[model samples]
Target: MLFDLTDLRLFIHIAESGSLTRAAERMHLSLGAASNRVKELESRFGMRLLYRENKGVQLSPAGEALLIHAQQFMQQLERMKSDMQQFSSGIKGHIRIFANTTAVTEFMPQVLGSFLARHPQVNVALEERLNADIVRGVAEGTADIGIAAGPVQGQGLEIINFSTDRLVLVTPREHALAGSGRIAFADTLAYAHVGLHEGSSLWHFLSRIVSQSGQRLELRIRVRSFEAMCLMIEADVGIGILPQSAALRHSQTMGLALVELDDPWAVRERSIVVQSLDALPHYARELVEEIRAGQAPRAISPDRNA
Candidate 1:
């Protein structure tokens, strides 16, 4: 109950390694010391959290629950250390961010670039995840911040308006759908499509829409980036549903065309999620502000960024 940070850390190390000896070596502690520390924890809990046998140590139900909370504890401790360092001369803080593909591709580059320019001592680790995973990760303390598109049932998170992500139909300049101005997602089913990678959020979203349309969306090619998808579309491989910001930027240079999507879901809004802004480390707060400043708002919202 009154375990120090070291106890929690060592237990986590042991849980990860699944062996007392290996964990002791990793922690630079003797096997006897590690064994004693684990015994003390078992005494505190009044239960055996781990079962040892031939291969390695395995967690009981209690150990499994403790591992979850212990990981969260480590994340918070790291954030606390980063926050405290801000009080010293230089910033020297690291903020971890998990964001969906739209945020990473269309928004974060310039925002993070400007933030790093202003705060040289701060660093960031960013991962592109699905919108659902982004929400869950931030809520579970896996990351300090989350950038996701569409409405989030944040449970008590502070949701700040980030940006509007529009999905438009991109095609060659002479394609029939190119000059249609706006078209339903289902209408595109008859034509071949240049799709993003299978794991990408856009690809999943498009796949679902195409499935729901009850018509086959002929797949011509798959590319990793929006630019690549656009290039393939330009070469007449097929049409693609791409982010408006990306499609517009490349369409101008490649002389491609953009058509509005008739479905309401095609236009998505993004938001920044945090458990508590007031509780964030100072440098993290600054980083949030930097991202907020990059909000290229295409619509009005109650808490739009300044």
Candidate 2:
């Protein structure tokens, strides 16, 4: 027997809501109309689809079997519709992105601003996460794209080099090392260092540098965020090595000084990562090009100006 698509939709809705009354309310249909649809479906199949219970309606064995296939079919149909809409509208669709804190605060604004100006119809959603989490979001299909300090390891991910950023030592203006140019890593390590927690990417980068130099980093306090590290540095707790983007944003306004690290590992490559290189959507490709072509230079250091 042939069943209407609307009948399948109604069945799925009823199964989801677990009540004929609630399903009718959700579909904005009269209770009689909703009941008729379910009755018609059960009659056509020659089986009991639902059974009334004290808590709510429960799907019968036959109903449960049909519900699974119905839901999958509906999802695929919706995806197809969305794809056609995007193609017909010339790259107008919602694109969700995950970025690190430094990228969100400093780098992304200019790039996203320009893109939005050019493609006014497209909607963009952004979330700030840790570098590792950003990579995971893209890999897990939670985000369409991601921007991070370095390429994270995962199969089926296409990582393209977009830019480079440097880590700088930030201190209060009156600190003895404030005016110094390119402060040696050894000198900074001698003093108490305000840094992020050991597990953080920033901490890992610095730890690797110190380990290679045959010295252990002396940590005065471990903060969970770049903002907290800056605040502690401002309070003269210790010096901090923070992303240049983050450092420059607050250094001038907060009356803090930023110095370059002499260590070789101070600079990091920033990249745009996507799930699949072969099956990228048109808008995704455009966004990747925009990121690579429009990346800004790293924040200026005292030595560069002097």
Q: Which is the leading candidate under TM-score?
A: 1
TM-score of each: 0.76, 0.59
Decoy 1 TM-score against native? 0.76
lDDT of 2 by residue, 168-252 (tens): 8888888888888787778887788898876565676667678888997778999877788888988999988888878877765
Query: Could you tell me the TM-score of candidate 2?
Result: 0.59
Model 1 residue 148 distance off true place after TM-score fit, in angstroms: 1.7
For lDDT, the strongest prediction is 1
Q: Candidate 2, overall lDDT?
A: 0.79
Which pairs clash in model 1?
Answer: none
lDDT (Cα, tens digit) per residue for candidate 1, span 1-306: 558888888889988888989988988999999899889989988998899889989999999999888888888788777678774857677788998777788878988888889879887889988778888888887888998877777898888886688888888878888767569988887899999888787888777776887778889888899889988988999998888788777866785878888999987877889989999999889888878777774522211111
Which stretches in model 1 have alpha-carbon errors above 4 Å?
1-6, 24-33, 75-89, 92-96, 114-125, 141-144, 207-220, 277-306
Off by over 4 Å in 2: 1-92, 184-186, 195-232, 299-306
> In order, how many clashes per candidate?
0, 0
